[model samples]
Target chain A: LAKTTQPISMDSYEGQEVNITCSHNNIATNDYITWYQQFPSQGPRFIIQGYKTKVTNEVASLFIPADRKSSTLSLPRVSLSDTAVYYCLVAVNAGGTSYGKLTFGQGTILTVHP
Target chain B: DVKVTQSSRYLVKRTGEKVFLECVQDMDHENMFWYRQDPGLGLRLIYFSYDVKMKEKGDIPEGYSVSREKKERFSLILESASTNQTSMYLCASSSSGTSVRNEQFFGPGTRLTVL
Candidate 1:
């Protein structure tokens, strides 16, 4: 399993673009970067996932460099409701199974100010 | 929409008492997982089942056991609950296949307090 490092906390204002970066220096070949957002008193929700290059969803965009050593989650227009803890995980399955038994680190907490 | 549901939203148990946490998924997913989340420890996998009656230990399987009698249901049992076992327990389910992405659907979670 690859260990990931992210900022402990980040702050942004309304309508600002917030970019959270995660560093995984020892990523494996089959590893895929996935991001999850967790609000207070709720389970983490899948935000976006990408292998390389860029992947965009309605809510956010994922940018992965060629080395795959790191990735960035970009929120186009932040809001008060966007305040949550964001997690970056490198999915690595055990014995070719679909379940990665994902390692969730102490994620980056994004605080959106009004 | 796919849904993963737990048996309880909140529970209170006494020390030395046996505790059971139930999780059910409606998506017919082949993989079901049990995880406990703490303030600084994030989410740690307790156990997971790939198929019916099949189980595997995860990162933090100590003091916790799981049963998967059916495909859609997985249960986590703590033989003797202790105050340290008190935390938010979350359940998740995902399909089984090498080609499928590891997008798990999570339940709302069960907040258990052991006194």
Candidate 2:
């Protein structure tokens, strides 16, 4: 498994875009970058995922550079409710030898204010 | 929606007591996992079962044992609860296949406190 490093905390305000970046220096070719969001007292929810380039969904966008060493999760028009802890993980998908174990680090805490 | 449900939202037990945390997934997923979350350590995998009657130990599985009797259920057993075992327990399930992204769906979590 590729170790992931991200900011310990970030601050944002309403209507602003929040971008969290994760660096995985030893990322493997088959590893994919995935982001998850967790509110207090709740399990983490899947936000978005990408292998390379850019992938956007109804909630967020993931931009992975050509190098694949790092990836960024972009949240558009953030609100106070968007405040939560965001986890970035690099894991091998279904085909690889991994058996669906996710290693979560102390994720970045996004605090959104009014 | 994929639903994963834990037996309890909060539980309190005494030291040396037996503890069992149950999880059930309605999506018929092939993989079920147990994890514990602490203040700063994030989530650490305790155990996971890829199929019924099969199990695998995760990063922190010393004090825990797991059972997968049926396809939809996985159980985490703590033979003797300790204060250090108190934390939020999370259960997740994901389908098995060759898809590129196998996102795990999580339950609400159970907060266990050992006295």
Candidate 3:
């Protein structure tokens, strides 16, 4: 499993775009970058995922450079409801001894201010 | 839509008592997992089941045991509940595929407090 590092917290205003970057220096070639949003007292929800380049969805966009050492999650037109903890995970295929486990780090808390 | 329902949203149990936490998924996913989240520890996997009657221990499985009698249901058992076990328990399920992009769907979690 590749360990990930992200900002502890970030503050953004409503109507502004927010980007949270996660660094996985030892990311494997087969690993994929995934982002999840978690609200207080609730479970984490899937946001977006990407392998390389840029993948855009209705909710967010993921940018992965050629190095694959890091990835960024971009949320367009943020609102107060978007204030939540965002987790960046490096997904890997399970093998004989390793089961598919989504290891969550100390996620970045994004506070959207109105 | 995929739904993962937990038996309880909040549970209060006494020390030395046996407790059960039930999780059921409607998606019929082959993999089900139980994780406990704390303040600084993030989410720690307790146990995971790949198929019916097959289970494996995760990072923290000392005080927790899991049972998977059917494909849709997975239960976590606490033999003797302790105060240190008070935390938010989360259940998640995902499909078994060859891709590296298996996204897990999580339940609303159960907050357990052992006194």
Model 3 scores what on Cα lDDT? Answer: 0.86
Q: Count backbone clashes in candidate 1.
A: 0
- Name the runs in model 3 displaced over 4 angstroms: A92-101, B98-100
TM-score of each: 0.91, 0.91, 0.90
* Model 1 stretches astray by more than 4 angstroms: A92-101, B98-100
Q: Whole-model Cα lDDT per candidate? A: 0.86, 0.86, 0.86
lDDT of 1 by residue, B48-108 (tens): 8899999888888999999999898999999999999999999999898422256878899
User: What tens digits encode model 1's per-residue C-alpha lDDT throughout A1-114?
Assistant: 456678889999999999999887766566688888999878788999998999999999999999988899999999999999998877544565544436665688899998
What DockQ does each listed candidate score?
0.49, 0.52, 0.53
Tens digits of per-residue lDDT for model 3 on B25-72? 999899999999887566778998999999988879999999999999
Residue A44 C-alpha lDDT in model 2? 92
Pairs that collide, model 1? none
Kept native contacts, fraction for each prediction:
0.41, 0.50, 0.54
Q: On a 0 to 1 DockQ scale, where is model 2?
A: 0.52
Over B12-114, each residue of candidate 2 has an lDDT whose tens digit, in order, gives: 9999999999999999999889999886677788998889999988889998999999999999999999999999999999897423267878999999999
